[model samples]
Target: MTMTEARPATPLWRRPWMFPLGLLVAAFLAFSLPPYLGLDPARSRIPAPTGWYYPVLVAHIGFATVAMVTCALQIWPWLRQKHPTVHRRTGRVYVFAGAIPASVAGFAIALAAPFGPVGAVSNVFLAVLWFGCTVQGFRTARARRFGEHRRWMVRSFALCMSIISNRIWGVVWAIVLTPQLDTTFGGSEAALGQAIAGITTWTGWVLPLLVAEWWLGRSRGRRRAPSPA
Candidate 1:
């Protein structure tokens, strides 16, 4: 048989559970690193505007943590396929516990964001896209369109993962590139860090999401077209 014909239609190891498990590990490390390793230095840059800022920051962190944990559970296919009843129950919890609170706190932080209005607007768009994807995922699943549901869930998970990618890129740039930018522009480390963080945050989250949406839409279009006899 030709290579394409010999390949299995569905690989056994290419299960849905694997993706979420990997994402969970990533999310866990992303949140745990700062507290455990003290590698993230950006915590110092969070401007304390008032007593409320601290509380808001704390809330943002707490909500985001919960959201990531619940997001992993919601997406894990072993739990979803083996126990759909439990999956539905957990899905409700995930939507309420993860999506709503995180989106609200994220928006609040975005408004007072120090990176300026561009960063603020980017964050707002991020939250909206995240929330919209989750809602669509739930709606599509309820309508019993599994393909649409999976597509929406993929979009939702991609945005949810921005929480992890933002920190990863920030740390990389701070450790490697910030010194060069500071020397070249005659700017402070703080300014360079903010610039790098803002750019990475947008590119890491928004660009990939747009690309995924385009690719998925094209695949779905191909699937829907009538095959030649």
Candidate 2:
């Protein structure tokens, strides 16, 4: 038998959770994308003040969707092991057509955020981290530093998926903090909403990145551990 034929199939038990997670991500895209697809500024979740804002916002969302979808394929071990060409192609798409453009637009959006400075700062940090991690990941891959490449890519992917976490945190924060509206936020719903938005936006990406770092550190520790004789 040829080498390819002799290779055993990857067991589904390995990282079984990823499949359902991908499905969830797909479901989110389905629910969230329809309104934005019509190019209607009125449908924007975030305010679109200037004429350029809506178009840029749309472009940012478009490229981010591409990155989110393609990164799933890129990080799938089964696909990478079985079809390296496809993995490489999709990785390129994630980096060039997705993350890069998305981050650039995200930076602009964050800078021009209609909300207060706290939310703007949080989003700007996210955009910068996403861009830096993605570019570093690509560079490491090019230099054949596979270990570092994997680490950086994992960080990039976590940042990419942070929007999902942002949504979850937003709901959680609203539920937990809404009651304190009068006492803590001077009874201003707008003030409370802005505070929650900033908190959620910061925690969304920051918490995920922290978790990713922990996982990466654990993996490295395991790799460095001495095996039994």
Candidate 3:
């Protein structure tokens, strides 16, 4: 088959649904496992770090959960196209219900992070990026700039996925690094785990944002250039 003919005949597994399915599964696991593991936000094993507020912590987790789930729905290409109205409505809900609340909670929680000021700084950046992208997305959509809106929203959604990526990195790093740290420094496994989680949380979010920014910028550049006659 010719290249153009072959393109339209690609298999389902090679389509966008694959990534969305993976994200959905990961988000479900992240949300469900915490409860089963007895990792309640209402209580912390570590003393409430500097600025930890119980109400805010609860709100943060709640918002984060909503954001993660809604994000999964938003990013699925089939759902977005097949149900455009539903997508727009849920996108609104995601902005108001998920993105704004989560960003507020994120900023609050960041101040109390156990890793001290550096962690707080990183989290503040995360919250700002999350909120900025989300707000820009809504603004663009309201103006009927669908392409710009979609791109910005995708960046926002990518930022939200860090919630899942953070935990996955934490688990993997803990498994691999715990023994090494324990043997080398005679530190508790718990301490090693905390260290890994702290580092990964920042890197996971920041790296994706950087990548998304590059992608968005390239897209905008292409859109702005005049087409050849």
Judged by lDDT, which candidate is best?
2
lDDT head-to-head 1 vs 2, winner: 2
TM-score for all models, in order of appearance: 0.74, 0.95, 0.73
- The local distance difference test score of each candidate is 0.69, 0.88, 0.72
Best by TM-score: 2
lDDT of 1 by residue, 1-229 (tens): 0011223334326675567667665656575646423423346346655556556666666666666666676666556655567767777666677776777777877878777565678888888888888888888777877777778877877787776767676687666766677576476766675667677678768866887789798998999999999
- Candidate 3 displacement at residue 137 in angstroms: 0.7
Separate clash counts for every candidate: 0, 0, 0
Compose the digit string of candidate 3's lDDT tens values, residues 104-218.
Answer: 8889878776655555787888899899999998898888787778888878977887766665776776677777885754776656655675677787787777788888889
Model 3 gets an lDDT of 0.72
- State the displacement of the C-alpha of residue 223, model 1, in Å, after optimal TM-score superposition: 2.9
- Candidate 2 positional error at 158, Å: 0.5
Runs with alpha carbons beyond 4 Å of true place in candidate 1: 1-12, 16-20, 23-47, 143-146, 175-177, 182-184, 218-222, 225-229
* Clash pairs for candidate 1: none
Tens-place lDDT per residue, model 2, 79-168, is: 777787788889999999999999999999998877778999999999999999999999988887877889999999999999899999
TM-score head-to-head 2 vs 3, winner? 2
